[model samples]
Target: MILLLLILTLLSLSRGRPNSSIVNHSTQLLRRLGVKRVPFQFDPYKEGLYYTNLDQNLRQVILNARNWTQISTLSNIDFIRAHNVELGRMQQTIPASSRFPCNLSQTRSPDVASHISRLRPGDIDIVAAFGDSTIAGTGIMALGFWDLMVEYRGFAYTGDGIESWRTVLTLPNILKLYNPNLYGYAVAHSLSADVKRSRLNVAEPMLYLLDLPFQVHVLIDRLHKDPKVNIHVGPNDICSELCYWHDLEAFLRLEERQLYASFRLLRDNVPRLLINFIIQPDIDDVMNVFSEMPDDCTTKASFFCNCHGKYKQEKYYNVAKRFFDMQKSIASLPELQRDDFAIVTHEIFKNVSNLWSRNGALDKRFMANDCIHYSQLAHAVLAKLLWNNMLNQTDFTLSEARRRPFEYFLCPNADRQFLRTTGDRF
Candidate 1:
């Protein structure tokens, strides 16, 4: 009877096709080993179509037009606009809740020790700065922004504490750097870029960057502690200029889903797990610093120009605006709208970049040789801005006098040394 059943199963699998012999033999072999063939369907739902039921006239509307001005016309499509409007009306009807109480008077005081000591078992306070080289501090990791944030408690001299990538460190991991047990996490890389290649700096491919298994491997190495992750990178997404706007929009939507899944996994494993994201600096504003530099096109063979070349400043501006819009859309996502999931805005960095542009200080002095990364002075200013933003978001205030640029640097000597060493050479 068992032999007969095996023969019947083999015949069913074969269907007498050209490759029936191979199929029948494989099925019979599996049956002999008691391996049942279980058939399953892998079907995924498709994303809802936006203008599926629209009339021909409305269907002709190009919702996602290339230029910002064209996008405003009635011909442009807005799939989410309806949803956003509905949400806005609902918000008006609901009572406002203050998850973050503005405690302007409560500054970072002598009670720092108590704050550091307040961590109970299973309590997690992670500051995972995820982004491109800016968050990584690239070559500045040893003497860069992270060190500066940790060095200044009262503005004297303090040594650098734990490295940012250490997974298993102590708790009370707020802004303080001296806590030997405290942990820090970095999910950033200097060359971390956007989804396509279109005349932008191409170091790593976007598909690889977004690959689940690969990201799990990279992130797990540093983020295994299940800490609250903070992402501060996005400008690189549009660094290619005038390329991949659709790609950027799609990437963010997919990323929102991935982040929600990743955060859920962490939340299940860690206590009070949170995720924060900082909007990137306006690339157009920063690019203006490079744009105004004198063009040095000596020859037609000169393929590259260091801020001194004929480049479309408006293209960079448009891309930056679109990038900011994409970020705002992602932040407004329901999954990322939780109290634990916060978004630090772009106003502070935007202001600083604008200051540099207006003062004609966007020269080589403020940036590295590549004219991309920040100089030591620039880093100091940018770090203080970030520090202040964090302080405000957490409802921790500082007396205006305490917020000096020099106070943030842990070792100004080391920073200067690193800058000098990498100056015009990097």
Candidate 2:
């Protein structure tokens, strides 16, 4: 059975298209293997049962070269209905009475920051993101296995501009409320990163930490060539698993050198830039949630982190801690901190696994259909957390934060006065 699964993975990696027979056979094998089905309560639109092997299903479908054809036939109405259902769920979670309206009249600071350190959320002109499939938004909206190949880029927490914060609630969308003319966010979904529609979201699915410099290069090239307005590029890299951690120091050193070089190039060329380095959730923390799941679904952790299943608990914990420390060390590099460019690291996701589970049962809605990436709802929550972090507000424990209504993070009455008085700085 393991050999057959390996064969399927290799076949999916091949460039040649697999026939329908192969796809059907793979699907049957997956079902026979008793893939666990996660329960979701709010499926008003009646999307199929969510499965742990959705990513595997997606791989098979992509190998068949039929993802686009299938998506093309899917109606825009389907997207709309799915969106509406999400909105309905959000409304239930966060009632309107709990929300406080922001004074849109007083948006940006009176003057732009001479140094990136003082840059406010309202001052950002362009929004960008880099990382792996999580940042690429692979399978964010997949209702079933077949829908997994779609890159719902616009719903990504780092750089999405599908609609307003009222609906989609992404970081870019929230920033748009402050700067209406904010450019460079992925406006809608795209099949691939190379497409023009991907815009400033240069993230690619399955990219490793080593691949970040290349993505930085692509983003820089795009900024230089595009005739769009110049100045102020706020690029966020939502980093995930660093690597296998076979040689942790070596991996960190290589990544640091490459990333420093890339940032230095951007700083020298670009006038005003803010680089946000969001620390990913601890792998052990995330894997713990899966560990509690049925045996069939527990293997999903291996898909995201190769070391999780193989390593001892003590070794995994030590490696994970060292990885996070290295990330902070890289962020603190004196050379990378400049007047025009600054790197800010957010540590909110360090304990995010606590947010997804309550009393030992996982909340399936916060996760994507693949059971790997975040769902649209989770992306919205992340956007709020990132925004709160930017404001220098008290960091809410993910579990505590989940209990509060979304509006709790929005415009507070106390903030309104501060926002009104301090139009010059935030």
Candidate 3:
């Protein structure tokens, strides 16, 4: 009987179906662990964690791919709904106002979800979002706000879990095998030496300054190569506040020179694509804590009081205005109006600010243990925003309320399914 089973297994392996071959091979994996029987039925989306091989296989679907196109129009989503706890305020740690503490968790509002739901997927089916922690869904781990909306779009989810800086190739051609729906997704991240800057905070403004044009070029090029790709670029890359408070005299010089080179390349290579430009509201006022300190030579005195006290939020709002202006300038580039590119205004930071103000109460988990990184709630907001920003179609409509199913998110309890390390490397 064992010999007969071997012959049958060999026969099954010869078939062209990848799953059949996979399951047969998986049966061997089970046998090694003293589990004899294997079910023929498997749902990757729901059961992915159980079989490490399957999870590994799915991970491969995103990392390595080329010559791919994906389609889906409207995204229906489930946000990981959970109760939140409000705990320590940033003021205790930063010695600043309890009101303003680089708090993104407070800024994750869902009204944008409604706007997103109102969009239409049109002809595009796939999306590629590439950038820093904002795109990585930092605060809301289970499902970033973007993921929620993308789900509604009827496309696959491919963004990485955290700040996948400059790794534009996260989901390469190989990912297409399982996600026949795959078009492509790109991620580009730049840090101010890692933790110094948050989207709510501006880190190394110079790195972004120089890399922007080049990254923009890559986005355009990819869009051209694959028109099916609805590309969202620039939000996680630029912060209007940096220039507001920071004297760009030195960095500006570098950017001015590098930007021209990069722009030239982008202009020459970037294809027209449906676009969304990410912008922050009140960046100069709120984020550029240094915008008004006399460029001459000032200590933390003048702005410090204003930052934590009364004028505190005024600058943020004002700086946000300037940031919006810059967004407009960037979008107005002659290329934006071209027949090929469709620019979508992603008033991202404004939405964030709204969330911050209306965040009912704080969820202790919303703040990271380090007082910098966000907790799960934060990532959920990010995923929500991403979902909103990406699906720019006229027909699709999104929900802004926190009405998502808990089960949909890949939660911590799912860790039981973590794959055993294999000796192999991809």
Candidate 4:
């Protein structure tokens, strides 16, 4: 009776002809069980279409399958072994020698820059970040679906200060090689943002463009209370992700007004600050990468940009482009470019699609299990890109950055001193 029920379920689920060997085996089993014929006729054309959709749904189910009790009861050793495997995989692509070189005996500038424009990499004392999950370091070290929820803040590309650039290449880690006393970067995994470990990385997961102002306020408040912080000569390194979502012009206009007001607040409260505004990649390019991913991965990624469909993608792309242009315009505003404060827009990720493909197939190694967030290797590469962009290196491109046997960008002879630049001015 149980076998009969199981066979009936399989037949109902696959209403089309059995083309695969597994399906043929099932048909043979049904015959041995005294089942005369299938309840419905099979259509060859529909079989192809039906199985395609069924395969996708089954993949999603399999991807999401996890033993919750086992995951909850996992030992520290289990996690360590998993992380080791992941680290080993990443090292296979990016070796330890490719990590940014560190100079432990390096010294800070004798005279810290009183003006933001004159600040060097070693001059930065405080590092803070805001925006979305990318800045917060979501899923950078994830090995599975369960791990994807864990925010490995220390692995973030922007303001992470982990062991060293060798273990995890991040902007803050690279800067630490110059300034050992650099403060405010998240050190380890944090289940929530309202924890002591979260530090100055106030970025939240799944946050929209409009939520940036709130994050700015939170960061400002934290900075004021921290006793170790001295805002006078201590230049703050602020990294922010400003990606677009809404299509309405009014929405963009409102965001601009709020962001401008937030900048004004920062300028009024915090002096000697260098804000790095990271512009996201093109929406069409992101969608193209999604299209190349497995069906389950694409379905998961769609939630991030559900507003963008086959017909509406162009509109979203235009809006995102406009938002990026707005950021550039805002950065160039004379009123905002004071000696004490400066906002520099980094367009390194504007064409990130170059890194998503290799040999005409989606590079799964560069993406997390969810296929939404970047993998650790991807973060390491982006760190190099950001560093190169800040140094105003024109030769380094995204395509070259993602190449195998990864190579760190060499500092130009004239700019080898780790001095910071707006990339637009000296």
Candidate 5:
């Protein structure tokens, strides 16, 4: 009887269809070990289709493909929904937003669930967001907002997550990916060391600078044509002390002029462009937190403690605040205000910092070992905040929102996720 059972198990493995009872036990073991793998790989560019791999005995697909076009043609893609099994469709799937206990989850009504189920492919919004580390979703050991959105099947364009990307670099890249025709005409240049100057030199190199007129024209035209697509530009223009209010103001002025030109070209092509900014924790508060630490708690002991050698602390703080204030002023500009163009400022981190401060020092609960970056909890909060913001926008209709609320967001809890171990790396 034991020999017969062993033979049956071997047959099951060879057939690629393990008994449901056996799969359940394996899944439980994987869940306890805190790791799970999706059953199949999906190609996002090709409308999230799945491909099948035949056993060694069968003739393999695309065995002799010489190039990408040929490989694409030969791919044995399984388009039938019944054959393309989704792991998330299982009954015991984990919640998408359950990475941390602090992360909030929404409960939708039955009506909402019905609408979500009825949502078809291409109904989801696709956003091309541009920014530095913050917009890229840099955290100690957490999923970036872009990652979360991608995992949930709400299409968000991604680039080098660690690159020191600026507006000039991002805008052209966005065009290149979205409008290849326009991108063909856009000039290509290496990023300059001086972050303040544009490589194109048509205007001040900042978020507001619209040097590539043709690219912007194509971008707006595409946005008008595709209502499901949106644009998000969050520029962290001021990184060092060299950038100031005048530079940011000048940059915004250039951006406004270009935007106006685009609007004039296509009267109804106004995009729901979100010019969003995040207000950081107060420099004064951060400095006070450092001061309260023991003498032994130097930069070596704690990355955030006594950083800048106490002498340069105030200077860094002052420079940061200068840019922060400038961003607020730009957001308030009457000329920049319009139905299609919206300026969003997030101060939740600042507010939380105040609450977390005790004895003139911030607790490390929501902060990372380095005082500047956020902790896992903070990353979860930021993900939800950004997700909610996306939902509130016109790009996310009610039907779309209903579908994405419960979708699995991959990499919710990744340990040791950051690269380069150093205080100044950030």
Candidate 6:
């Protein structure tokens, strides 16, 4: 019987058919392995589409299109919207509920010492930061902007943090040396990017730098305790900038399901977590609405994805609201924020925008050509956020701030340099 089943499964699989034999084999594999599903098939729903089939649209939209209407109303065959945004009432500012993050800062203060101190001295620690490219550190560029990299907390958003392929990214993640003033080694960090991007800058390397510190903390903690624990995940989640193109309903259902599942998995396993949710931080994100949507799409509020990416990103931010709610649900016990949890997000992006605005920063190492990601300033922002968190928890005192590792710099003067009309020469 098993032999017959195996033969039939091979026959079906070979024919590229979704027949009973193939389904049964996959089903059997799932059952035998005691797993609900496997993601080997890009579209787990067997929807007959995959990422390999979804690349061209990105270029057409980013490189060719002149406006939002051209990009949003795609023609011809279908492609999935990787994200969804609701085109609701356009306000001048983001709703207050959507602006400030939950009062985690207030609630967790009392329990920090108690919870952090209770953890086993040497138990490994893990911190995970997930989201789009801002999470990936694709900041400032050398060809156009230099000092621009000093925005997204510095290097925290650029490379994949892996030491492998060097793709000469838009935001070149090179070390700016003070001793030599410019003699740092060419860091052979990994993660290659293709030049075919709409521009020279590779897309944001999300899920990379954001996960490192916590992972390192966990690794070091385990080195002193146990040598076999890993921490933090990368920016490989199925997030994208063009998700606004999908039919709002379908886009949202898929997004909610995926996010819900992702959060649920973390909730189930890791009680102590740090998250850096990266939705666009623009004044426009709050004020814009796209009423020119399809007639049947009556749920304008639910599918808020319109392309006012700058100064307005309402469609982009609504997603953040949901992520936080999910956190509140999972950490319902109330004490998780003290020792085992935290979240860092892009607040006041407009403030950081001009700092590295056009990506032609004075700091050549900043801004990836992709108009996102980071160099140094980006890393600085991340470190600052975490550093401030530790401060809030009293994990480290003011005097000990020097011992805490993270490079922070807010360049108010970089505006002139970033917007320099002069030729590019960092």
In angstroms, give how far residue 122 of model 6 lies from its true place: 11
Per-residue lDDT tens digits for candidate 4, residues 1-426, read 000000000010121222244334434443443434422335432210012334433432332232221234233535743674555424343355554443434335578666655556667777877766777666666666666665666777776676677667777777777677778777765422333566777666655444444555566666776776665100000112222323246656855675576667677777667777665555556556656777777776766545445425565457655765665676568888776677766666554556766765667777766677777777777777777666665343547544432465645333465444454542
Candidate 1 lowest-lDDT run of ten: 1-10
Candidate 4 has a TM-score of 0.72
lDDT tens digits, residues 10-53, model 3? 00111122234433443454444343333445543221112345
Candidate 2 per-residue C-alpha lDDT over 213-294 given as tens digits, one digit per residue, 9 for 90 to 100: 4555556656776678464111111123333345555555665565565556556766556666676555566557666555
Candidate maximizing lDDT = 2
lDDT of every predicted structure (CA atoms): 0.30, 0.56, 0.30, 0.55, 0.29, 0.27
Query: Residue 63's C-alpha lDDT in candidate 6?
Result: 26
Error of 5 at 176 (Å): 26
- Order of models, best lDDT first: 2, 4, 1, 3, 5, 6
What tens digits encode model 6's per-residue C-alpha lDDT throughout 75-107?
310221111111110112233354221121222
Q: Which stretches of candidate 4 lie over 4 Å from their true place?
A: 1-107, 192-194, 232-247, 310-315, 394-398, 403-408, 412-420, 423-426
Model 5 CA RMSD to the hidden true structure, in angstroms? 22.8
- Candidates in order, TM-scores: namely 0.43, 0.72, 0.39, 0.72, 0.35, 0.37
TM accuracy, model 3: 0.39
- lDDT by residue (242-346, candidate 5, tens digit) is 233334444445444543443243223443333333444454544454565445433422432223343255554465455446545544556554444444444
What is the descending TM-score order? 2, 4, 1, 3, 6, 5
Off by over 4 Å in 2: 1-70, 73-100, 192-195, 231-249, 294-296, 313-317, 403-405, 410-426
Per-residue lDDT tens digits for candidate 1, residues 167-231, read 11111212333222333322112122111100011111112112222232233333332343322
- Model 2 earns a TM-score of 0.72
